[model samples]
Target: MGGGGTAYLTGYEAAFINPANLAVPDKSTRFSIGIGTAAGFFAPVMSVGSASRQFQAYKNYLDAHQPEATAITASEKQLILDRNYPKGRSRSEHQHRMDLILGGIQWRQGDRAFSLTARTRFSTRTEVGRGWYDETFEDLDSSTSVRDMSLFQQSQFLHEFSFGYGQTFDFVSGLIPRVGKLYIGIAPKFILGGSYLDLQYDARYWFTDEMDQPLFTRSFSYRSTGNFSGATRHYTANGDPSAAVQRHFPSSFQQDFSDYTTPTGMGGGLDFGLVYVLTLGDDLSLAHSGNTQPIEKSLRLGFSVTDLGFVSYNENPRSLDHARDTTLTPFAAASGQKYEGSPGQYLSFFDEVPDLNPFQFNQVGRSDDSPERPFKAVLPTSFNAGMLLQVNRLKLAADLTLGLNDSAFNNTKLIAHFGMEFAPVKPVPIRLGAQVATDSPTLWSLGTGIVMKHWELSAGAQFLSPRGSPALNLSGAAVGGLTFHF
Candidate 1:
């Protein structure tokens, strides 16, 4: 289904492809939103905090200093000594989820045009365990023991907006005879970003009920962790002894986000394009030319680049929490006691022992998992290119897109798309397309659309590929959207 409308040839579905191509903005004002789900091919990785180890370390320090006593309730003790401390959350995304909601208005007044577009996107994820537990406690029910185990999961959303303008001029007499018009355009964009990730998990253990009926306990938990890493020295709780805590974290997570305009200040970029018409007949405007019929329409070619410039972020170093010390209290094993009083007492507690390094992965307890690290934020970039054939009412189109990581770390991905449109009736049409990529499975799609006097509507379905790995594969997607012209 090739050869049809001007929009098909330029592939500017939202006027985002090339602002200049929007010169003759469609009369219909439209809005479009797309939703898709993908499987994360990778297994979910877990992070945890060691409450037991932390308690043991605290106990050792207390024994050495022997501070004033303060009795506490069972609930208080559980809150202070529980081994499972909340350690924020983690997310596992399967693949690219094109979850975007959009609305826009295009204004076409003769050869000049302008458009405004805005969109918001939402995404989700989850993780299941390998099914195993090593930590065990005495069971009360029937003289049996139980281990702690669980399943973990999370979800995110973002918003973006852009405004553009385009102009066109018939210039065949100025340049080549076959060429028709030159187009120029530009757009400014503003993006608002924020997300909420809820990490939920279930831990199964044992606790005796009042009836002494050996009861099993199930705990549903959540954590709220933020990005911070640094070092500090201060008196522990009471004024007993001075202690230092060190926080270890990656740089990516600590970036400051106070300022949020265009990442590179207030600067913007421009987009340019050209549409040429080739005629097969003799020239009508030429020296000693006889009467001739000029060609009205022919083949058309188009090209454009969006966001070709860059936005630089603010340069500010982040503050970090200090890593903690495992042994401030010296142990006197021969005497089965320890001194937490001061450096003098610590020296006395351990008469002779090997010196240790302060900066270590310090294992607080017997558990194998490392302490949960601070979370990180990531931003992305994308590039697009496409072509279209216009022959009366039939329009065929194809496009290529690449997404690149422009953040602290980088990964490259490419996507290919092909589609055709057929318009049997003046305002209604049917469309079909397929997406191909090396990193992703092939996706086949079918769609239909309508262009009314002032509004445009479209609906589509896509069947994703990579036939196997059902748990981590993208099955299919249902997409629909609307656009408006002012």
Candidate 2:
């Protein structure tokens, strides 16, 4: 919900957000399908985008083990809390979680109509630490050197396909005939698959002017003859004093900052309606009444500007390997620069290097590395209204919508929506709705339909705001999508 916006619903899912409202059909050839899943709780706000560099490397390991307390004594703070109490236990991740599944079909002919849909969505997240790194400095100070570090961790996967068509006309047939009905819809979209990943980070350094001594007098002699004391530690040039690290992971790892993502695209639109019928009879007074009638249902409003596509990606996947050189140099002379044990001197860099066998990324010169690219970009628009009422066996229908990217008022946008259907208790058909917006969270929907004659069953629900906060007081906004019909 941080972009590519939308909101203005006609009826359950509103044809994936408006495909000429799928030729406004209550029957004829209407087969809709929908499945929904949602999980929310995202709080990562540091700003400057790119997930604020993984929250500045997770707040620099929580400011080096959560310090900031006073008046010692609880066994001197329980031995400084057992050397940092298991790294001050940390866990509460959910930056962005969402799931979706959709299906559709509609076909009508006399004036012309057609629709088709097949949608699939699966997004991944979980990015915290790792973004290129190679640092070493006893005190090259920039808040304790080791800056300009970049490790690797990010994720993404998507799939899509959609299409629609509609047509209608009646500009007073032949001579002096009634004038009404004029619809026009056109939809086309196709989005392919996905995959993109890049990761690697190495570390190590001894700054205090290339330390010979002074890391708290070599790890805990409590000797503070400083250049920033002697007991400080920071390294990642492939750290391995005796490796073993991994606190927790899995939140889709920050989705690797996008460059492309629009699954597919297409567009076209138009719709208009009018209905009138009424009668009343029974003689009475004055000049004597014989018959009187009045009834009118009108609808003339709709819009569309869909997909409008483009998606392509590749963001510098790092690389640097000099035949895995080993550092060596203890001392040397003659400007060849060296002073302590020399065999190489230390240097390494890798941003997503593994698979020693199965190398991938070809096509610069073309030997077949892997082609077929596009990442993300989208703009789906919609606006609608409908009405019909006949009181023979009892029938009343209603529909209304708004969605120009959910609206902030592009000519009055409250993404207002409504639905109501009733057909006298029997075989079944009872619907209800109320969707209003502005700050968001004001949904109340209910639906049910059964017609076991040919084969029909429908179900729907919309009642959000589970906790509220589509990023600050959308006032109870959660429940999203659920549908079925045949």
Candidate with maximal lDDT:
1
What C-alpha root-mean-square deviation, in Å, does candidate 2 show against the real structure?
21.5
lDDT of 1 by residue, 381-457 (tens): 44555656545556667676555542211125566777787878967877877767643345666667786655556
Segments of candidate 2 deviating more than 4 angstroms: 1-32, 35-95, 102-150, 160-191, 202-259, 262-478
How big is the positional error of residue 282 in model 1, measured in Å on the Cα after superposition?
A: 14
Give the 10-residue window scoring lowest on summed lDDT in candidate 2. Answer: 217-226
What TM-score would each prediction reach against the true structure? 0.46, 0.24
Error of 1 at 330 (Å): 30
Kindly list the per-residue Cα lDDT of model 2 for residues 1-486, writing each as its tens digit: 111111223233333444544444333334444544232222221211234453343333222111121123335333322321223211111122233445555555444446565554433222221111111222345533322221222223344455666544234212323323334455555655333222222222223445453221000010001110111111123332111111111123343212223322222222222222111122111111111111123222344444444323332222222122112212211111111100001111111222110112121213223322222322323444444443433434444445454111121243555555565765686666665554333556565656543344455544333222232221112333444445
Runs of candidate 1 exceeding 4 Å displacement: 1-13, 25-93, 122-157, 169-173, 196-300, 307-379, 406-411, 468-486
